[model samples]
Target: MELVIGIDIGGTKTKIGLVDKEGKCLEDTFFRTKEYPDIDDYLDKVVATIEELKDKFNYANILGCGIGAPNASSKNGTIENASNLLWKGTVPIIKKLNERMPMPMRIMNDASVAALGEMLFGNAKGMSDFIVITLGTGFGSGIVANGKLIDGFDGFAGELGHIDMTLGDGRITGLGVKGGLEAYVSATGLKRTIMYMQSKYLDESRFRSIAYNDLHGEDITKAAEEGDPIALKAFDYTAKILGLALANFTAFTQPEAFFLLGGLVNSGKWILDPLHTYFEEHLLEVYKGKVKLLSSGMEGKTAAISGAASLIWESHTDEY
Candidate 1:
């Protein structure tokens, strides 16, 4: 059997998956990324896991290895200053991996890989043009046009989170940018929206009583699920920003649909219901009633690992 190794590198956990061409994960195991503050230590553990998986699944011929990570440069197979990671500077991931395993290696931003996964195995399958917007700790996007993922000249494209909304609302992103989409539409943004509303509305709400540091994402989700007015209003506000931004994004690629993924998406109808209404309202006449906003067909680490592995199958789509 022919298989490929897939790795999904995140801030907290790294998942190593052995997958077939059909995107089935025959086996998967993970190590804590945070435990290895030094890049070399991290890579050592990752490589060991890969070898263990290879030994356990000895019958399969592993073709290549693909990886998805933050602040990754697919063009260079290096990670450049990923804020979530403890290590500094650009790490030559491919070189290190090759020194150990010695196979074809490819890497890209995690969100971009998720988009690739969607194209190969999820709802976006057979669709040429679509966008995958992940609403997680921060906003991340993967744009597909003309049946190919867009990895620009330097492999730093598809950064939709940095789109400036020019709200002038004083909400600054971790990137130190003001009015960026991620500052208004991500999970971080949602929490900020709740806090802002808590101050402005003077409404009797659980969020108001809870300290900012003590609050949890799940708490807010539960409140919204139960129809808490403050949480609902916050969702409405956040969705409007995202909906408008998504409408504008259509002008660039004219994608047939926008597939949403990540933790914030778990809020379900609390966010999606309002998002659809606003997205339709703001879309240009030429594009109205055409672009669909839907949840991602594939979810969690499995899809992500498959997405990373799918890079090996593509002839040129975001190839390193």
Candidate 2:
């Protein structure tokens, strides 16, 4: 069985895995992403880690490397201006990795790789058209049209998160975009909504007991599950914004479904129910009742690692 090295670089940690073709991670490990201030040093550590894993598993005949990172470009094999990472400017990740490894390496933004993983080994199997929306600390999306991932001109397409949902004068995103979809729908967005609701409702809001810095999405979710009015309202408002944005996305690509992935989906019915309701309400008549909203078939570290591995398989089959 052929194996691939999969790397998922996040704001805080980097997960490396040895993944097989079946979307199974045979071995995995991690390191703090923030700890490496220099790109070369980071790559060196990654290579060393992979080598250690290889020796431990006695793995041989490695296919290649597949990486998912923020602001990564599949076309250029580079991560450009990734605000989350400690590195500045464009980092030629593929080039850097290839220098140390014998096999080829490919790179793409995290969301796109997740979509590929779904297409190859998850719920999206046999589906030619779909969208994967990741609702975590931030919002991310991957669009698959005609059975191909749309990388766009700069390989930065499928940025559904940055869509201007508010029209104008809305919550500012970390990207400095005002009223961006991520500003209202992501985990960070949920916390912001909770904070806003606390201010508006004052003593009437249950969130009044929580400190601004201590409040988290999990807290809001817990409260919503328990029937807290403010928490429920926050989820409703977030779903409304996300659903409308999804509705707009449907009009453009008309995907068969939208798979919601990541931590926010754990809120379960609290988010999905309102999201489905608002999505249908906002969708165009021609698109209404056609597109399906569903949760991701894959999750956790394995899902991301599998997605990264799938990129290697995809490259071999010309399916990427």
Candidate 3:
């Protein structure tokens, strides 16, 4: 039984898993990433977890490890200046992991790993060209063109979140970019929309009683489900931006489909329906009705684990 360790590093939490070639996470656990301010302590815990998984499973062959993190670079084997992380500088991820566990390992940003996972195991399995957008704490994207992951000159490609789409007055992102796509369309973005709508529109709803800090994306989705006008309007607003941007993206690579993943995707049709409408309506005549928008085959922790583990198998393909 050949297995690989998959680690998904997030801003607040980290998901660790033992995965096989079939895209299954046999054993998994969650760890607090923010709690450890030091990278050495964090690596020690991760290495310990891997050792426990190996011993418990008793697999004949334990293959390499794959890590998906914010601002991670496969070329440099380090995570560089990630805004959401506690670490302030470039952390040598592969070097630290290799010191404890001697095995073949790979590292890439979360979105890139997710895109690779989609190509290997998710809905975009057979597609040669596609994009995966992650709408979590922030908006992120991974692009696969001609069946190869495009890592740009230094592994920082497909950063759709930072693209300028506004008049530079929109909400400031973690990286201090105003009007960035992530600040308007992510789960955090949805919350901002709800609060803004509450101020402008005097809609009498449950959200009125909830404080701005207390409100969440899920709360907005629940409100929309119950026919709350404010919540519905928020989705429309968020979707239009995402749709227009996605439509514009078609001209770049003309992907066969765009797969949506992460927390905001859980809103289901509330987000998808309007996104499709706006995307199709705004698409250029040449690209109209040719591309598709698909949901992720695996969402949440499973998607992260499977995506990270997919890197272990990524070498088998000629496409990188």
**What's the lDDT for all of these models?**
0.87, 0.88, 0.89
Tens digit of lDDT per residue, candidate 2, span 118-212? 99889998889999999999999999999999999989998888888667788888889988889888888998888877767754666777786
Question: Where is model 2 more than 4 Å wrong at Cα?
Answer: 317-320
Clashing pairs in 3: none
Across 1-320, the per-residue lDDT of candidate 3 in tens digits comes to: 88878899999888899887777888888889988899999999988877777788884487789999999988999999999999988899899989988999999999999999888877888789999999998999999998898899988898899887877877888788998998889998999888888888998888888887898878888999999988998999999999999998998999999998888989989999999999999999999999999888865557898899999977744443
Q: Is candidate 2 or candidate 3 better by TM-score?
A: 2
**Model 3 spans > 4 angstroms off:** 317-320
TM-score, one value per model? 0.96, 0.96, 0.95
- Candidate 1 Cα RMSD (Å): 2.2
Query: What C-alpha lDDT, on a 0 to 100 scale, does residue 304 get in candidate 2?
Result: 89
Pairs clashing within candidate 2: none
Residue lDDT tens for model 1, 142-235: 9999998899999999889987888565578888878888988888888889988887797778886788778767888899888788898899
Worst 10 residues of 2 by lDDT: 311-320
